[model samples]
Target: MASGGSKSVASILLALNLVLYLVITVIASWAVNHGVDRSRETASRLPIPARIFPIYFPIGNNMATGFFIIFSLIAGVVGATTSLTGLHNLSQWNAPNLNAAAVSSFTTWALTVLAMGFACKEIELGWTDSNLRTLEIFTIIVTATQMLCTGVIHVGVSEAPSITY
Candidate 1:
């Protein structure tokens, strides 16, 4: 068993990681939205900035710009909560599913970059703006986080003695 100090360190790290995750996620979302805005601005077209996005797994057109719209809305709530209370987390009702949200978040980030990069003319596919690869890697990492947490939760609960009908 780990010592109390080590456990405390781990918990702190976990909390920090969650905060960083949400921060980076919101940043990525905004970056994509900015890309959208730039594209529209350059083309002189008007598109409503998405303010809400789906937290569910997005696929095909389901993973469309609509998802970003939903995300924008949710991010606003998350940001407000964090700004007001310095608490960075989901409710217990939603905590176990965070990894899934992360999946959608990173995928949205990647696709937004892709649309703005290869599909649009907002960013150069330079060394740093290698958004596709970066998003891909992030997606993989987030997916792994989901799987690991699922496994840990399964084993943890399996070892418990409680029986709930």
Candidate 2:
């Protein structure tokens, strides 16, 4: 594909990913807050094993829910950051900028995939709220979008004419 084509594709994907990541961040933050509050209320009444674990989520898919939420939060933040970097790179439209954006986008995609794995686990465990289910769907979608963004950036970088010192 032409550099212009790649840039447009990356821009669109980055925008989409940014919005999805922000949504994930907000929902995950709410879930974390809810989980903490519930855990605090039941802390004293909880059993030894439950009390021992620092991150205990009383709702959703039990243990897997906690992992999923944490990872989703991480991925959301990283993905947002990656999107910002990608936007900057798009504005510049150079090999170095594209490379940097590609690296960050790849990292964010990996984190998103990790979160998606936990999402799958949470799904398998069952019993999740509507917000969590929404989060899972977004995470899965972002994983693919992020990968596409990274791939497009890399292709753009590679296709650019080499600079001689």
Determine the backbone clash count of candidate 1.
Answer: 7
Candidate 1 regions off by >4 Å?
Answer: 1-20, 44-128, 163-165
The Cα local distance difference test for each model comes to 0.36, 0.87
Best by lDDT: 2
TM-score of each: 0.39, 0.94
Residues 21-90, model 2: lDDT tens digits: 9999999999899988888776667788878788778777477888999999999998998898789888
Clashes of 2: 0
Q: Which numbered prediction scores highest in TM-score against the true structure? A: 2
Pairs with steric clashes in candidate 2: none
- Model 2 has an lDDT value of 0.87
